[model samples]
Target: MPSADLLLTDTHIRTLDPAQPEVTALAVAGGRIVAVGDTDDLVRDWQGPGTERIDLAGAHVLPGLVDSHSHPVWGLEMATGVDLSGVVDLDGLRGALRTADRLGGWVVGWGLDHNAFEGRPIHRELIEDVLGGAPAFLRLYDGHSALVSGAALDAARITGPRSFDQRAEVVCDGEGRPTGYLVEHAAMDLVYEVAPRASDQDRRAGLVELLSTMAATGLTGAHVMDGSGLDLLAAVEEGADLPLRLTVSPWCMPGVDRAGLDELVALQKLGGRRWRVGGVKFFMDGTVEGGTAWLEHADCHGQGTDAFWPDPAAYSEAVRHLHAAGVRTATHAIGDAAVRHALDTIEALGESGRGAHRIEHIESVPDDTIPRFAALGVAASMQPPHTAYTKGDHSDEWSKRLGDARAARAWRTRDLRDAGAVLALGSDWPIAHYDARKVLAMARVPEGAAGPAQGLTGLEALEGVTSHAAIAAGQAAEGGRIAVGLRADLTVLGLDPVTAPADEVAEAPVVLTVTDGRITHRGA
Candidate 1:
């Protein structure tokens, strides 16, 4: 009716809507699905001169894929400089640094793995010679820490340990000299502040390019985990349309008082047509590899007993404040201790916080913590590809740190699903590759790096990125299903995601992508 804006025909639609599980055609008008039924019947009735119709030629179409955890806008800056993701050992790391290009007279590289050190502590002395006296900053793969060359430590004027509002540390030697290892956001910010940064124009352009690249991989929406690029998002929309819809959650770190809470609450009003500040992100713990994962017991390195928040009660108070304001929250909880504390905080909120809170990166948890997710209505937001950072034989840094028992429980995707929890999946880009297909593939099949962790079924994995994703975002009523009156966000693939082999699904051809009733990407 009213001249459909878009009509897709000759396709097998996997409408997650229970009422109509399958349909051949769907019509869209004003950014919402207008109708769905037999191709001939719907097209004959809804098609008009103004309608833009496309024949999918039997491709399989599903609800537009959503990355539950991503940092597309912020990642442009985080992922800049030379990529060290492929470097495997300290020698390789040194070689990469020797050949790394400079940015504003400083050598910068990201995605450096801790295993490259081969059990050696992360110290500038390891790579200072390779830098040849130039200031160098390298981001550890976890994104929670950084290793700077001695020159960089001097450049940032970071002479010794300092206090931070959060659980950050400027790692130092026994002699009281800076070791060039910065732990957590605060310590890393010291160097990053003085480091050269891209101009506002370059950052905006990079965001557009990065998001467009994600669209080519079949992403129609993303639950951006940080709120750094709100102004850039608004600026981009002012000039042109954003390739995907983004639900941003600004961070609420430790030491926040009433005034800071008020500032975060007011940020909820900032948004553009395709992006909105819907929730607040919090970090309950740093990363396992960084020796700060808040584990119940000490790691092999005797670290991880501390939470990211200097005062655990302060974090609980902040969550309570946000929950009272009808705000949803997601906390980074990678270790069992951190996960337990986060759940305990929500449990104290009673029925109101049941489904309003979520736990991100439940990397290793006890058996008891599994069922509480469904019981408390807490969504389990996990990144499957993160397992790639480990090794099956317990040789990688993450596995060795946790020992045998804890590492065995790594990324319990299937267990959480079976326990009736809302399991939302993503690639935590900048931490892992952002390809949505890999998220599905890794979820369905636990490769060697996953270390005996159970994987999800095809249908279950599909729901992780679709239905469960929407439930996690509290948008279950409008998105995640192909039905009349739902948002016209859809992804067309060369094969059915639910029936295809995991490997095949990983490389499935993205035939087309539609966001908000407009085609964003189409393959030849």
Candidate 2:
């Protein structure tokens, strides 16, 4: 037997493997777990003069966390721009825009919520007043809508009201003049076309920084639910070694032709082990707060819109096409109607061993739809911290949009688990904090706070960010478990998460993180 490259000892390792649930030590070689067992035995057998040994000092180790769905590039890009997440009113909005104005360039901001405006509609005039006629574009927290100043509208050549096949609309005033608000991607693209894009250098730096930040939080892998896989490839091409593994999903929107599908399929084969395109992503409905989620009926009598696709049948056909091509499909479905439609589409494709078709943010679903997730083999990728954005008393914008009865069903993690669905958890970073501890904390106390009886057990919550998340990323066989042959990706914690109190688990510190046998982060 060859000597191992690295050896970790004096640790309580929770392997997540039923065969060898617990071990005292593990040996890594060639970026994979070569052996795991009694610390003394492995040390004596595997250690060599060239091997490096680390003492964990009785820390608890588990498989490194995997964020099943996140927007790494988007988050990093937003970090460089003004963050409007703190804006609570029109004054705050103006203040943020004013701050951005001082920074110069095309003033870009994100995380604005209309609910914070106290029922006042966001007008171009309001933004123009702050920018002093400078072009500025701000996106809502939901990412489904945007507010652009008159200067930006002129730059984008957006004049009167325009129609889009994908249910996107440019809001118009009573006189049919364009409002600053734009709904859905089609509408938002007009602004993006005119807006200055981040330089390749900036994009590469952002990706590297974001991945490093993720590693510090004990994340060894992430399912990047964004459209910028090329940026990651560019970073790698520039000789930047990513800190963690990434399974990228290209954003696939409605009206995509066969050529567009081919482009995505080509992107899938671009990267090596550190990053790869795992699947295609779609948005079925917008969001509850945006009044774009396809609910059973209109919440608050708003007449919630139709699916994002111009033709519902065409959307199904697209899923079927991808499923047939051996590619996984992940659809963002936050409302009951959208959830049903996503499930129905996946079910229509029949069974296959290709990939795990999933629904991101199954925030609201009918009771019957829960069981179908398991029956249909659809992975439920959800973020628990998203609930923290809501008020516990159901007075939050999202809750009010959902009403009383449906509001109680927000993020039904336990119900989905009880119904035998595969629940994969994530942070959806930029929208919420990316720390795994906070996510676990929210998951532990979801009852009454996030949703009625939606809380999950400590072990279940752990699995959501570990094993289940790996499965959702289509790496079930190679990672997720701390078996002898699995990848050497591990997270060393201060205590045994499964045995500790939920609150304690949330506070537990991450002592170290290892990805592919390389120590990415270490804390004293």
Q: Please report the candidate that would top TM-score against the real structure.
A: 1
Tell how far residue 31 is off in model 2, in angstroms. 0.6
Model 1, 1-524: lDDT tens per residue? 47789999998999999999999999999999999999998889999999999998769999999999999877887897999999999999999999989999899999999999999999999988888789998998899999998888898898888999999999999988999999999999999999999999998888889888899899999999999888899999989999999999999998888999989999988888899999999999999999989999999989989899988999999999999988899999999999999999999999988889899999999899999999999999999899888888889999999998998888888889889999999999989999999999999886544543578999889898888999999989889999899999999999998999999999999999999999999987
Query: What's the lDDT of the predicted structure labeled candidate 2?
Result: 0.82
Q: What is the TM-score of each candidate against the true structure?
A: 0.99, 0.95
Question: Poorest 10 consecutive residues of model 1 by lDDT?
Answer: 445-454
Model 2 C-alpha lDDT per residue in residues 132-246, reported as the tens digit of each score? 7788888888777888888888998989888776878898899988888888878988887778777767777767777887888788988888776565565564685678888
Candidate 1: where is the Cα deviation over 4 Å? Answer: 448-453
Itemize residue pairs with steric clashes in candidate 2: none
